[model samples]
Target chain A: MMFYINQTSCISPQEFILFDDNHILRKATGGKLFALEPNYKNIPSAQLRRMGKAVRFGVGAALPLLQQGNDVNGIIIGTANGGMEDCMKFLKQIIEFDEDSLTPGNFVQGVPNAVASQLGLLSHNLGYNITNVHRGLAFENSIIDALMLLNEHPLNTYLLGAVDEISDFNYKIELLNGNYKQQSNEGTDFYESGSQGSLAGEGASMFFVSNKKDAAIAKLEFVETIHSSDEEEILNWVEGRLGSHLIEMDKIDLLLTGENGDNRVLKYYTAIESIFNNKISIARYKHLCGEYATASAYAVWLICELFKNSKVPLHIMKVGTPPQKIEKVLLYTNYLGEQHSLMLFSKVK
Target chain B: MTAIVVTGLGIISSIGNSAEENRESLIKSRAGISKNNNFYSRYSTLLPFGEIKKSTAQLMEELNANEKGVTRTSLLALHSIQEAIEDSKLTLNQISSSDTALIGASTVGGMCLTDQLFIDATTASKGSEYLSSYDCASVMLYLQNRYKMKGIVNTINTACSSSSNAIMCGARLIKSGLVKRAIVGGSDSLSKFSINGFNALHILSSDICRPFDANRSGLNLGEGAAFLILEKEEDCKGKKVYAKLSGYANTNDSFHPSSLSEDGQGPFLAMTQAIESASLDASSISFINAHGTATENNDEVESVAMRRIFEKVPAFASTKSYTGHTLGAAGAIESIFSVFNIINQEVYSSLNYTSPIEKTGLVPNLNYRKTSVQHVMSNSFGFGGNCSSLIFSKH
Candidate 1:
């Protein structure tokens, strides 16, 4: 089933760019790559003050897309750690106050569905609002739901996206688990540092999707996710998915990967890389966005940019000759070598 | 188009450990709200909750789930999912197949260990085993890894209506030919995190809840899990088919984050759309499982919505009066109860109801009795004005 990406917006670590403008990729110098949030002058101050970073980026990125019209049938959001700042603050307040006389402000905003709910409230698009919190597959699952809903109702437009914020408390907790590298290094340098952990990252990306091909920049062709550590199993699944679409591996113009400089999981990317065999341009994005559960959302935004520009950005290209004309792009991302996701996108012709 | 049918049901709530036990409790008009004995909380003594009687360790041992980093939420989910899959007679091969989907929902996934997470973040230099399980997706991820589920595995967290949306999503998936079968439900364990959160909101009732009562106080937060196996009607040949998932619709009030509109527009749209989707008239609905949290806002608004939808509202009751408000798990647990209403051709009474609200003069069924239940509508409205309605009809 094909779904059109009618409009796209993102707030990531990289500098915000327009569809026709030249892109500039930013690099994280430390273990954390925080979002370069735009000024919320467009949003009402009272509402903006209550939103956490995730909800801000989410509603900020989504509100503009809904401005075209308020006919959105649903608002779907995905996040692994939603509204973390408020969640932690509420948890801390419970302890400090000994669970007495605490306010509901933070608690209400801390729930994982806060983004979708907030968007629904702001846009007044009281449709099928939902949130997906599945680890690495969060954004992909949102896409799947949007696709199914559109397929069920072709005329319906949906606002789908993902958001995750990096908090001081969460960062420290994750550091204990070695989810981030110990050393401070440039994003690109860390990719080749042969390290054990990837840099932490946070961002929000939203897409307006519908079944209509007109006015669409790109068409999402396929999306699939799996939980496996075996490289061969993932390889076979990718091939099977492509074969179902009747597309040859050589036909893919760009192989976008979520290689976030984790040495242990580099082999999985390498295994997938061998299938292309230098036939197509391969690029990486986590260097710009860092590595988070919904980093794939940023990848989708990048794919939209590449399709809009019809060229691969120099900073993201890692291997293979740049394609003369970018047509079909394949995105393969893995979260710690366990959660594997494959998404295929093509220029809407 | 293929019709979706519920072939198997599994549930673990305060009233019982299995489906049979729950059925017996409902038949005997048993209410499960009580003081917490297994879960520890500051208000555990002051407030009543629909807490499962067993401890986490006992649940783990009973389910043989000794996996590291497993939380109580995951354990409850595993207990119910085991029963669901077994009741459906689905083999490991079928479960591991790519055609099967598991869509779980939870608002309190692994946040049940908020205390541990707090200690690890604030005091301990090193995180505990519960560190990785602190997110809302942990429960579904744990279940997926345990079952080695190869198909679409996703988790939805839309507050209290989470599992209703899960069930709706599963039905849509099966109807869309995306998957052959789906295991859909939600699980939430009572914890200090949620208790404090609810208390902070000033919605937690000290006494057992009284849904639709004239002078209802508030809701008692509960803990439980429920899963239902849904497949195409054609697929369940000789299985113990419970009911057909005739229709479902999800809508938002777009009104407030924590409160619905006074008119209950979201619930009205949800109920109307769900009935329309089933291609049935509002008059056909035999019983309704209302969202009624016994709050001043919810019960009144739900009654107004019911009045708007039906000329004379059918026999309806709030199972939350029996189970307390189970939050994320209430949708599916009540959905299973709705199945019992169909399979047994009966309607369970709403407990502790005295008088109707003056605004709507709506009185819920106060007694359990056998009836010709053909279609049942289950309502779940959650935070963010997320309202959903599901209809189950006799197969």
Candidate 2:
């Protein structure tokens, strides 16, 4: 079954709130990059104060895409470290107070599915709801869930998205584990540094997906996720997918790679580039959004914007000549050479 | 349509370490709830829990996993996952193949190391090995890396119903021709985070939990892991097919974050829809493994839902008396109990029940007995009003 994106809302470090205007595209550096805050005038003050970054962004991004009268039969969300700020606070409380008289607010709101559940409660969506917490592949897993929901119930509209946040505690852990670069550097020129780590970033992206093609920004042709580090395994996966879909390599108009200046994980993207003989136009998106577990979701939102505008971002370094017609865009991303995901998006013509 | 069958079952909870042992405990009406002495917890003296006897070091030694960063959650999951793979007779090649999907559910994951996380956050040390093992997906990632699994691996966290959704998602994936087989289940070890959280909610029972009873206090927080190997009937022709996973439905109550609606609409819809999907009548089910958390709201609402669905409310029992509330693993653990009912043609008794709630006037099966069992419906409801029901029929 084919899935179409009816509406999308994104909150990233970039200035654009949704898919409207993109006048100020800020440069994401190697240090921590937080998403641009959105207005929360729609939510009650008490409820907004209780929510953490993930929930605030998640609800803020989702409310705009949901139509007033339309029924949402499903809600699926993805997050790597959900409500990290609250979780850390609870952990510290547990230790500081000698595990006595702990606060309930942090503990209650720290769960990974809090965002999805909050949305359900806010909108009174009494349908199938779930959350995936896999790193790197979380958003892809959400897409998979949405696809299955559409296939099982063709008439249902689903809300699918991902949210992740970077707190001081989480950032320190990432820095210690050699996941983020300590030195500041321009993200657009990430590969030029040949740095050991990528920039730390956080964001939330939500999409209103439906089987009906009305009011859609793009058509989700296919989405696949594979956990493999071996080059041959990944190549075999690509080959099998192409053969099963009956699509030639040349039919792929553009290749979106997640190259975020981390040389250790950049080889996987390079291998794919070589397999296609560097023929297809390759585009990079980590510069604009930095890197996170669900950064690929941001990349997907970026693709939707690209399709709507019919032009690539000026900061995205082009590898080859642009295709005559950008009909098929295949996104390939791998994090720390562990979880590899691919998503194929086609223009809604 | 290809029928999805459960060919293998694995479980390790406070009562027993394997399916047969747990079944024995069930038949003998054994309860594993006690003071939380086995694990380090300030609530050890104040609250009761279903904590496994084995320590993390013991688990590591038995599993031969001396890795520095491995957490108790991962170890528990690996123990059951290995048992499941062995019970299914799947070789290394099959498990590591691209067609075998692994879907794990966990509410706490490595966050069970709450103390260590607190230390890491407070101190200025460069890092501890436990840094990466802090989210709900860490255990799944550990398994993926350890087993060299190449299939689609995902993690689900919807509070208590996490594993039930995992099982449903796994079956759907196979039905959609995405994979040939699935290793689906969840694991959760006792931790201070959940204990304190549940304590704050005033839901953690100080005494042993009593489900559907008039004096039902609160729920005793528990922890363990259970996994089921699901494959198509055609592929498992000669294998021992325990039961067929026939129907499943997930619904949200949208009433409260921590409580269900008064009418139990989520539970009602999930059960009725599952029965419909199974192509069976409400009377066809032989038994039901109820999501009896022993909390004040859950048992009452669940009983009301049962009354709405079945006129007689078939021979139903809550195995939480034996396993406590295993959180993410509750669904899979109760599911295994339901399968045991189908295979052995017996009904396990519910313990610590003196009187039924005045509202529902429903009483569960109070004694274990050998009987003709054909189909069983398992209910798993979670926080945030996430409710799921699965129907398993005799294969």
DockQ of all candidate complexes: 0.83, 0.74
Candidate 1, clashing residue pairs?
none
Give the per-residue lDDT of model 1 (tens digit) for A290-323. Answer: 8899999999988988888887766777896667
lDDT of 2 by residue, A1-349 (tens): 5799887889998875333334555666448777888787767789999998888988888877664566788799999877889888887777778778777888778888889988888888888999999888999999998998898889888999999998878888878778888785854565667878888888999988998887688898888888887877787787678678777789888888898888778778777777789778898877677889999989888888877777665456458765556778888898777898877898786
True contacts kept of 2: 0.70
Single out the weakest 10-residue window by summed lDDT for candidate 2 chain B: B33-42
lDDT of 2 at A319: 87
Per-residue C-alpha lDDT of model 2 across residues B1-395, encoded as one tens digit per residue: 88999998999999998888889999999988877765677898799889888889999999998877899999999888888888989888998888999999999898888878776766888678988888788898888888889888999999999999999999998988889999999999999889888987888888899988999999988889999999999998678899999999998888887899989998999999999989999999999999999999999999999999898889889889888999999988888899999999999999999998999988989999999999999999998888999999998
Q: Compute the lDDT of residue B260 as modeled in candidate 2.
A: 91
Question: Lowest-scoring 10 consecutive residues by lDDT in candidate 1 chain A?
Answer: A16-25
Best of the candidates, DockQ: 1
CA-based DockQ, model 2: 0.74
Model number with the top TM-score: 1
